[model samples]
Target: MRAVQVTEFGGPEVLTPVELPEPEPRDGQVLIAVDHIGVNYADTHQAENSYLAPSKLPLVPGGEVVGRTADGSRVVALLNGGGYAEKAVARQDWAFPVPDEVDDLTALSFIVQGSTAWLLLRRSAHLAEGESVVVHAAAGGVGSIAVQLAKAWGAGRVIATASSAAKRELALELGADVAVDSRAEDMTATLLEANGGKPVDIVLDMTGGSTTDGSIKALAPFGRLAFYGMASREQPKPVELRNLLGHSTTIAGMWLPHVFTLPGNVFGEAMADLFALATAGEIRAVAGGEYGLSEARAAHEALRARGTTGKLMLDPKR
Candidate 1:
């Protein structure tokens, strides 16, 4: 098997393709012949050794994969690591059947980003119908899905924040009621103006640092801010306690692992629901780019440069 491995933590240059023995699935696990592997910001963090989770060196870096199980059933699987390989093992509990209508790349894109958006809206923020939501990085993988999910959930107004004009246009095409360029002026001001000077009820905050502060300011009284990722490249600023004092707003941190660990078949039900949405065309996977396994370094570079929008994939068959 060919896999991208990090012998040591560094940059995109540190990711190198190497041959490894094929892995066998243990009990209660499934062996997948990987077709498409989703590249996430988490992958970059792991490659740089800045990930919040502990990691071992000489690691194969990937979290989500869309492929086939031993019985040749198409499926999407989440892994702790080792997804960068041509073949990987995934716990059966962490795997979901891919609908016949969902192609490999598309299925792969939705499993991670779609699930994150779905969980954030339905669980973390407890988003209500007719409530307004502001999605940061609206052109990126998770942001695009978040925008669609917010619209599907009947948000009164979906305001998207993007860095470029192209990205803003893309967001508008994807059901965003309004789009703002977060790089210019103040994001909160733009969001308020777009919403007729009304604060948003929820904020899907993927960009941290100063943007987190602005997001907190843009919330309506009792609004929820679900912080998921840190794409701003700025260290997180200390949040003022008073920001939430009178408003009764809440700042909740969301990590998918927590949601997947919920008791009594919660994770299975959520995955099944997301798969149904994909089958119904209510939600989708936006695969922005696909690269061959050997081009792993280039994929990392593209993500690091922030030059790509939507989900990126590695095709082992390519």
Candidate 2:
């Protein structure tokens, strides 16, 4: 099987094409004939060895795929690794059948990004109707999902933030009620204005640097900010508990793996909801750059540059 391998940590250049034996499914796992493999910022982190959880050596680099089984069943799976290949394996419990109404590439987008967005609202932030919600990095994969899910799930106002105007527009297309420059010096003010001169009710934040501090300061009384990823590769700016004390602002940290650990059909339930939303035309998965599997290096570089939006995917059959 053809796949991309990273033997040493560095840059995108470390992702080299190679041939490896196709993996067989373990006792409780299933083998997938992979089609489109999803690309994510996390992939870039693992490639550079900059992730909070260090990656094992000789990693295959992809964690999710939309693929098929031996009997031609369409499905999506979250792999431990080894998705950047013609074949992959995942635990049986982790694999979900792709709805007939959903296409391959769009289905691929649902694994990490969709699930995170779903969990952020349903569990993490506990967003309520008519609440104003702000989504940071609103043009990236997870951000796009967050934007759409916020609107679909009944948030009164969904504000999206991006570094560029083009990204901001894409967020609007994804159902964000407002788009603003993420690099704007006055993010708190922007949020206030978007919320009709009031502090925001919920903030879905992933960039863990300065933005975390700003979101905390912008939180309305009893507001919750769901802190998830550290895409900026910087330590989160500390928020004084005193500031949150009287306002009742709370910072709830979320990581998807932890949710997976807690139990019953979380991913499955999320995927079902995601597919229904996509099929109903209420939400659409944005498909980004399409690359041949051998072009893994280019994919990594593009994602690391933070210039791509939507779901980045690789065609293994290519």
The TM-scores, one per candidate, come to 0.96, 0.97
Q: Write the per-residue lDDT of candidate 1 for residues 9-101, one digit (tens) a residue.
A: 988999998999998888998999998898998899899888789778889999989888878898899998999989999999888887787
CA-lDDT, candidates in order = 0.85, 0.87
- Which prediction has the highest lDDT against the true structure? 2
Clashing pairs in 2: none
TM-score of 1: 0.96
In candidate 1, stretches whose alpha carbon ends up further than 4 angstroms from where it belongs are none
Candidate 1 least-lDDT 10 residues = 260-269
Clashes of each: 0, 0
Show where candidate 2 strays beyond 4 Å.
none
